[model samples]
Target: MVEDETDQVTLDLEQFEETKKEDTKPTLGDIFTDRVESLMKHRDIDNVLDDQQHILNNLEMMNEKLKFLNLISQSRYEASVTAFRFHMRLLSGVKKDLDSVFRRIRTLKTKLGVQYPEIMAEVQDKYTVHVSDDDDDE
Candidate 1:
């Protein structure tokens, strides 16, 4: 009958549609995105991002140092640089002796203050500089 033939035709059309969907090629955007994702994974893009972030942090630190140097006078800059170097040396010495049971944090800070009395004062002065600038009328 014609109804049976129509039903058969409809079933054939449905099967054809399913096959068409399955056989369709991916679009250009899909292929490009997939390739990029695969390349990023293969090249360890996460490590690259971490390295770039570290580099950015170093650059930011250097920028802050340059800004601080620009803000202060040359003599003060030199003094602060020297103090920072000495502070680092002191910290290194403390680190070396940290394993000893007798070394206390407060004791180390007290010794540093005694040896470089002006060091903490200079650090406080550096932090206060911005505050003073903000308070100025200009």
Candidate 2:
């Protein structure tokens, strides 16, 4: 009976050891899979660097495009300024011509006043064109 008890106790210890190993230890397949996942993460470093480089290249392209746009805008502004100055000079010359013409008409009206006084006032009022000079350039 003592021998039988000792055998039974040994069998129970063996069963308990098997159960503890199954419950507490990882399988070889699970360990290998975890190692492969760690290697894949290490390999993805290059992919992460490539992604950053691509983003930087795109940013450089956008910066170049913005520089081109700025150049175009500046040129347009310069052309507009040149055109405005040309128009201003042309208008100033036109104003001078108009002033001379008005002076000549007034002289003619004064000369004809002695010959026909009645028509002088009518011609002065009808033919004189008054232009206002409100230019910012003094």
Residue range 1-138, candidate 1, lDDT tens digits: 999999999999999989987999889997999999976785588789899999999999999999888777777889989999999999989867874535576587678878898996786577754536557442
lDDT of 2 by residue, 1-138 (tens): 999999999999999989997888788997999898887876597898999999999999999999999999999999999999999999999999998999998797678998888787787688986666875532
- The TM-score obtained by model 2 is 0.47
In terms of lDDT, model 2 sits at 0.90
Q: What TM-score do all the candidates reach, one by one?
A: 0.35, 0.47
Query: What C-alpha lDDT do the candidate models reach, one value each?
Result: 0.83, 0.90
Cα TM-score of candidate 1: 0.35
Clashes of each: 0, 0
Q: Which structure among the candidates has the greatest TM-score?
A: 2
Error of 2 at 75 (Å): 2.6
In candidate 2, the residue pairs with backbone N, CA or C atoms under 3 Å apart (3 or more residues apart, or in different chains) clash, namely none
Q: Model 1's lDDT to the true fold?
A: 0.83
